[model samples]
Target: MSDKMIHAYSGDEIDVHWDKRLCIHISECVQADDPLFEVGREPWCVPDEVAKAEVREVCERCPSGALSYVDKDGTPEQPASENTGQVVYNGPLYLSGELDIEGAPEDMPGVRFRAALCRCGASKNKPFCDNSHIAAGFEDFGAIGQSGPGLDPGSAASDGPLKIKAIPDGPLKMEGRLTLKAASGRSAWQGTKTALCRCGASKNKPFCDASHRAIGFKSD
Candidate 1:
């Protein structure tokens, strides 16, 4: 996958954009709505054949932010609020609202409304979930206190840029303008600095429980 390349498919009513490098090959686009993302078909994506709303729905389901769309009517589709994230039970870290992944290539779309990040540390697509947790038998109870102090969204609002930096062989260091939520939609914490466990061994997950140190988790 070329990190700098963006493949775009323009249709009559909408345009579908894809960043191949960000795709984890979860097959959500092909499985959810095959008519638009047929693998063997010429041009592969036939956005004209499907309704604009249908195409947009599938794009939103893409966990890696590899897929996105723009309506010809000029209605904005990107999320326009504070960033938020949640820990899925025995699964990926679900993120929503406005987000900015730090250090992404200039040509790539740096911001997104939603993303399912891989927490198991087994994903072939490092940062994004490709449903590898299920295959890897990852186990987590999604406990509340394990995540640390909860942040009040109303109180933590700041104009700083949201940043997520993947440290070499370490946790995902998140800083600036973000909220961490539980599965129940309750705020777990809101802060400028939070280190999320990426090696899947954190007992205090989704926070870094220091298991990465004992397990010798190496991303590099």
Candidate 2:
């Protein structure tokens, strides 16, 4: 996935930019308003067909930051909140806010307001979701465990650069202000650091329950 491939769609008040490599194919844009994002049509997206506000709202919902829009005034839309992550129901781990993903692909954005990281262990795009979870029938309820003390809601609000270190063939070690949420928008866990499972073999679901070692899951 070359970082140079950027698809731009112009509108009356806003211009939308899409990085196909970052797209997870969650269909959030299409579901928001099909007329503007018809799958089989040329150009695929017609931003002018919908109100600028509506288009912006839909684009913001993209979990992978694959969709971004620039207003006529040249202002770019920002993330809704601070550094945070949410485990989608039987899907990828959705993240947003100030983030610095270490060791990411050269083509990937250095920083993004949102991203969908693969937790299902099936995505061809490592660390990023590619909608392979759907075809793989991945399932998880994102249950929290009785581990160490998690972060307080107030503490989780700190605006800091979240650091995500992807371990070669291992779990994702994260540090900095973070609020881990569940599918129902409930806080499952909040902390400044954590080792999250990526092999999808953890008995603890999102957490590293040491199942990766037992299963000998290799990723490097």
Candidate 3:
């Protein structure tokens, strides 16, 4: 704990990125209501700004490995995982490192859902990955999903719904009893099914306008 330190940085590291695994469950970093860390959307703790002793106290309390820190020089330190030097993809966010389709949630009795989240603001089906980013030539090298809802594990439901399947190197394949919503707050629940965009390049806001294809949005 004494050896731990949190360094302060200028705005030069704006390009610094963090994914799900890197976090240390240091809820303070992500808590906007009272930002103690002041560096992230939610604040946690920064050692260099404060005292080294205080930073170690906070880091030691983390329940999950959700929080991590970077050095002043911009180099990264290893976390406490047995798997070292893994080649993590910079894009196409996967849940706990699992592919999308296998754990996708079905619309049903369960509360969880399988919807895409938008990384770029160019998605017609923003927050959901639709192929629109690709069709529209929307580029998101650091982007992932760019369309479609996240997949959940276990269970399935069927009540005359539009079925969604994952296409290889394409937008999500949806065909079933589902609805599409527009930016105007209007919704189209066409039980027939539609492929929504996860890439945020859609002029359509929430539906897959196929703009990603035109934009050439690719999830690396």
Candidate 4:
């Protein structure tokens, strides 16, 4: 027990459950190759292609907890058997037991792994980024008046939740817990922490789907 942790990366393989507190903003996870570290996206890693040992080695090499094993969900059960007991189902991804991500030995220790991030900007799911606003275009202004399975955008602000803003003509800018509602059908998602679109321009329906990219979405 060195009392210190390490975080390592090699090519496009891991998301590196980042610990902003312990991390110095090193660009390793943000720099690695493709499919493994899509940067600005969830599942940041493609572990199958990369080896756990190699990842461990990289972590061992880091002076910071940047690559530390805050939680090993993306990995397998056998390899990270110790982590199995800590696994907690989180709908989209598995949450490892309270391990440690940013703690410098005494702070609230915990690790986060294989998380679904918010690409759409509408995520009532805190820390968890659901790709909703993206699927819906979610204009900045549009976010002002919308309802989802577990959220009512018009009123979420009063709850001290994240706020939404149109990027001028760009994708909606959501900065807090967001929820999404059914764009159609018999309301499959009854009540779940999610995010939907306001722009109503997402090809993925209620989600943003990044169609804004093709449709020339800008918020300037």
lDDT per residue as tens, model 4, 1-220: 2324433333454434444434433355546543444665554554545566655444433323334543254652122211111111121212222222221234312222212223333444322334344555544321212334453546543243233343444443444333332222122322223333323356543445566666664432
* Candidate number of the best lDDT: 2
Which structure among the candidates has the greatest TM-score? 2
How high is each candidate's TM-score? Answer: 0.75, 0.83, 0.32, 0.25
Please provide, for model 2 over 79-135, each residue's C-alpha lDDT reduced to its tens digit, 9 standing for 90 to 100: 556677888888888888877888665444423678888887777877888888889
Query: Between prediction 2 and prediction 3, which has the larger lDDT?
Result: 2
Q: Can you rank all candidates by TM-score, best first?
A: 2, 1, 3, 4
Write out the backbone clash pairs for model 2. 151-190
**TM-score quality measure for candidate 3:** 0.32
Q: Candidate 4: minimum summed lDDT over ten consecutive residues — where? A: 81-90
Collision pairs in model 1: 150-188, 151-189
Task: For candidate 1, write residues 1-220 as lDDT tens digits.
Answer: 4535678899999998887766767688889745899888888888998899888888877766778887899976766476777788888887766677656655555235666787999887767676788899999867666444444555544554567788878899887666777766677676667899999998878889778889998875
lDDT of 3 at 97: 13
List the candidate 2 regions with Cα displacement exceeding 4 Å: 1-5, 33-35, 105-111, 135-137, 146-159
The local lDDT score (0 to 100) that residue 6 gets in candidate 1 is: 78
Candidate 4 accuracy as lDDT: 0.36
Looking at model 2, residue 201 earns an lDDT score of 80
Off by over 4 Å in 1: 2-7, 19-45, 49-54, 71-76, 146-157, 184-186
Model 1, 22: alpha-carbon shift in Å? 4.0
Q: Sorted by lDDT, highest first, which candidate order results?
A: 2, 1, 4, 3
What is each predicted model's overall lDDT from 0 to 1?
Answer: 0.76, 0.77, 0.34, 0.36
